[model samples]
Target: MKRILLACSSGMSTSLLVTKMQAYARSIGDEAEIWAVGQDKAKEGLKSADVVLIGPQMSFLKEELQKEAEPLQITVDVIDMMAYGMADGKRAYEQALSLMENK
Candidate 1:
């Protein structure tokens, strides 16, 4: 199973998106572990994450997060603005899978 983590300023903002992603995963019968965390906790989260998606609000932290994730061989990227704004779980899930695939 793949472990995908989403990070934001306080983590709370992404929780809803995580819920949506989880629903999408269940619909497709995917066993991926999807979760969210605050920026301060992202490094720790990266320890077990296969891919990390950053909320648009925290996009500036991507470089630093990537630095931490790179050592762990985890792909880090910012969620698409439109998809994120719309809370498009399917797009988010597909994006996460694509990153894992190309990592």
Candidate 2:
């Protein structure tokens, strides 16, 4: 199973997105472990993730997060603002899968 970690300024909003991602994954029969954490816990979350997606509000941390993730052979990306704002989990989930595939 793929482990996808999502980080945002606070865990609350991302928790909603996690639910959507989970629903989308189930709909397509994609097995994945999806979770969300506040930016403060992002590093800890990264330890177990196959990929990391930072919420738009936290996008500025992408470079720093990527540096931490690279050595662990994890792909890191910023979730698209439009998709995130609209709570489009399918798009976000697809984005994560695409990043994993290209890696």
Candidate 3:
């Protein structure tokens, strides 16, 4: 199973999205273990994740998040705002996989 992490300022909004994404993943038979956390929670649990994805509200932290994730060898990216806003789970999932693979 692939591990995917989603983070946001408060982690509230993204949590809702996580639920939707998980449902979508299940429908497609994608076996991703998804988790959503506040930026602070990410700091505590990042070691377990394969990739870190930031919500648009927390987008500015991308550079910092990347640096922090370096030792863990985890790829991180800011979620596409439009896709996220519309709650497009599959696209976001694809983006995370692509980024991790290229890294």
Candidate 4:
């Protein structure tokens, strides 16, 4: 199963997005482990993540996070602002899948 990690300033808003992404994954019969964590805990989560998506609020950390993830062969990206604000799970899931596919 693919492991997708979403990181935000506090993990609260991303938690809601996680639910939507999880539902979208289930609807399509995609076997993925999706979860959210605060930026402070992202490093620990990155150890097991296949893809790392930073929330728009934390997008500033993308470069740093990518550096940490690269050695692990993990794809890292910042969630699109509109998609994240609207809680568009399908889009978020697709974005994650696309990154992984291209990697």
| Candidate with the greatest lDDT versus the true structure | 4
Per-residue accuracy of model 3 over 1-103 as CA lDDT, tens digit each: 9888999887887876788778878898989898899888876656889998899988788898888889989888888897689888878887877887888
lDDT of 2 by residue, 1-103 (tens): 9899999998777887888999999999999999999999998899999999999889889999999999999998999887788888899999999999998
lDDT of 2 at 76: 88
Cα RMSD (Å) per model?
0.8, 0.7, 1.2, 0.6
Ranking by TM-score: 4, 2, 1, 3
Off by over 4 Å in 2: none
TM-scores for every predicted model: 0.96, 0.96, 0.91, 0.97
Model 4 scores worst on lDDT over the 10 consecutive residues at 74-83
Cα lDDT of model 4 by residue, 47-85, tens digit:
999999999988789999999999999988999887799
What lDDT score belongs to each candidate, Candidate 1 first?
0.91, 0.91, 0.84, 0.93
Ranked by lDDT, the better of candidates 1 and 4 is 4
lDDT of 1 by residue, 1-103 (tens): 9899998899998888899999999999999899999989988999989999999988888898899888789999999887788888889999999999998
Give the Cα error of residue 58 in candidate 2, in Å.
0.8
lDDT of 2: 0.91
Assess candidate 4 and give its lDDT.
Answer: 0.93
Q: How big is the positional error of residue 28 in model 2, measured in Å on the Cα after superposition? A: 0.6
